[model samples]
Target: MLKTTSQVRALTPDDLPELHLLLDRDPLVNLFVRNRVDSTRLQARWLGGQVWGYFEDGVLVSACHAGTNLVPVQATRKALRAFAERVLGDNVRPSSIVGPRDAVLPLWELLEPRWGPARSPRLAQPFMVLDRDSRLTPDPRVRPVLIDEFDTIYPACVAMFTEEVGVDPEAGSRSGYRARVAQLISQGWAFAIIEDGQVLFKTEVGAATPQACQLQGVYVHPDLRGRGIAGPALSAVVRLVRQTVAPVVTLYVNDHNTPARRAYERVGFEHTETFASILL
Candidate 1:
């Protein structure tokens, strides 16, 4: 007999080891890579409603996690419904819920229709994956943010978010976003291309694991695209990451983003998986 329960809940620190192994073993997870997660980070992320998992025999077997940018469109939908029905007992509404691709899918598949068309897919944004290898060279001008560059780097970070994620890092205060940028700068996590006197290109390593670092907020100014900038700029960022963290780097791109994908491939990234997002 197959047994199941929605009483299952979000992953806890104690479940980290098991969850990590389960995620690592899944081929689909190769797109995100599994090493970036640990107990503490998972807890913080989960508390934000970005993660949920299922356990069996005291070991975490299945989990669907979401990030700030992408939610699990299918998995989360399934997991949440199962949880609500078995644990909450039908007190919740039947309306569709959406979030990042990784966060929602587990819930989406828990009942029936394990795989089907997305109810509300974010078609404009497609999932992309990049693998790190030595294909391009780092730009001499591009380097990690230094202690003195916060004033300038801060604005660039905000501009990156506005262009990439479509929301201000602070949602309002430009200064607040600056402060958040400052934090990443201090940690040696942010990078930029400095030419003459201004920033030209930039990207951030959103989640870094021993296995891989997920690239996020990659952007070049509108006029700067196809100017032989992205190739070297991305090369520099990936090179730096290989030096400090995982040698493999990855990022999600929209399926329709042909140009970006080509640029990434030129810099030594490969497509490893397809991911869909749910927006509720």
Candidate 2:
């Protein structure tokens, strides 16, 4: 194994170039961090998280974002071990650990004893991406959500979050969660198909940078699902994202969600990588 005086430290704006280079090595998979980096660089508060770098002879080899979510990028066995040790000792408790399957699983294995069992471990999430316009026709009804629609959209957003994450977004208080939904709408990142103030389908461009944007919180009302709605709605969202937000759109789906997987395939998404998440 390559050996040098390994040093791990919190990254700062001065490390931007090195960090950007490392993250760009796998831009699609690293979109989560790259989006934050593009907006806030190496600020400790970027996306409410701090980034740490593992350096060998002053060259960054691996990096991790520790906060609401734990994401390790390009971490080798040594780097993962070091990160696990560092975060465990510091008493940092992230809500979840997510990343490329190969990296997340091993990192979770190292930290599980210290962090306790995850509430759920999603071991196979196909990280899919789309660069070209979708093959399916875009849904004419789906459009960017208006700021005035936050009240109508909030419930759907909460429901989707709870269903997907297995925890109510409004469990503690609705104010904070409500504000987040409004923010996405204000930023023109929220989209939905609504009629009579009822959200039929909804989603958001949860994270973005010039190179790519990630789609999240995709939900079609229970009453509206399985009737050929998601495929075209998603294609519309993908089209809007490619036209106005970024050229590339990416999302990860639970491997077991064969229907969603097929729907995305119908929309022109292809599996680019695999991801895993240890939800705490």
Candidate 3:
């Protein structure tokens, strides 16, 4: 039966232990939240927003990271309703609602009436993972993007973001996006294959834990999309990432992206779960 006695409130540092336990339930899928908590330790000054916890008779059963991404952690049906209530009551509107399909779908259903008409709702996203070297030969040319190659990598990233997300990231934060790309390169999280002065293939480790890491900004040059650059390049990524970043590399792609999924499969990534996103 659904627990009747419950309380939902914004979490604090004191709640970190329970929060950690909850987030650890699925580290690969929860890497983004885990990374944020590890870095900020639930500090609002750093987190920029709150993570709400759903408690049943004094035990944290689930949580929702309310910020640029409204991500749910091990959310139950009851928890989703409570979280929706809290969000609406406080008038909190996140840029996106995303997480595991089971949790994200129900929560969005609860919020869509008021938050109705999402700008872009991606309902079927395959959450894929690769924990070992790919069967395909790694593309030897793909390597960590050097700081000097910032000019070469930046345009590819913008194009990928615009094509994938349907909006130019530079449209909002001109400098912010550039700094992020630079930061990822400096940290050795960004990888690319550049020839002369052009980026042929590129991707980045968007988030990570010691257990696993999530990749984003995967792209193949527009003019060269059909020549099968993604799979081999990602083979290189999986190999290098397993050696340097984490054992498991994960990413979620829209279910409709056939070529991307096929390329990921060619690199030996298997679909482990379904995720959804409601972009606001």
For 191-276, candidate 3 gives per-residue lDDT tens digits of 98999898889999999889999999999888999898999999999999999989999999999999999999999999999999
Tens-digit per-residue lDDT, 1-280, candidate 2 = 9768898888888999899999999998999988877777666654577888999898999999888789999999999999998888778888899999999999999988876788999999999999998889899999999998778998899899999999998876778888889989999999999999889999999899888999999999999789999999998999888889999999999999988899999898999899999999
TM-score, cand. 2 vs. native:
0.97
lDDT on C-alpha atoms for all candidate structures? 0.60, 0.91, 0.92
Q: What TM-score does each of the candidates earn?
A: 0.74, 0.97, 0.96
Query: Cα deviation of 275 in candidate 1 (Å)?
Result: 2.0
The deviation in Å at residue 37 for candidate 3 is 1.0
Clash counts for all predictions: 32, 0, 0
TM-score of 1: 0.74
Better of 2 and 3 by lDDT: 3
Clash pairs (backbone) in predicted model 2: none
Better of 1 and 2 by lDDT: 2
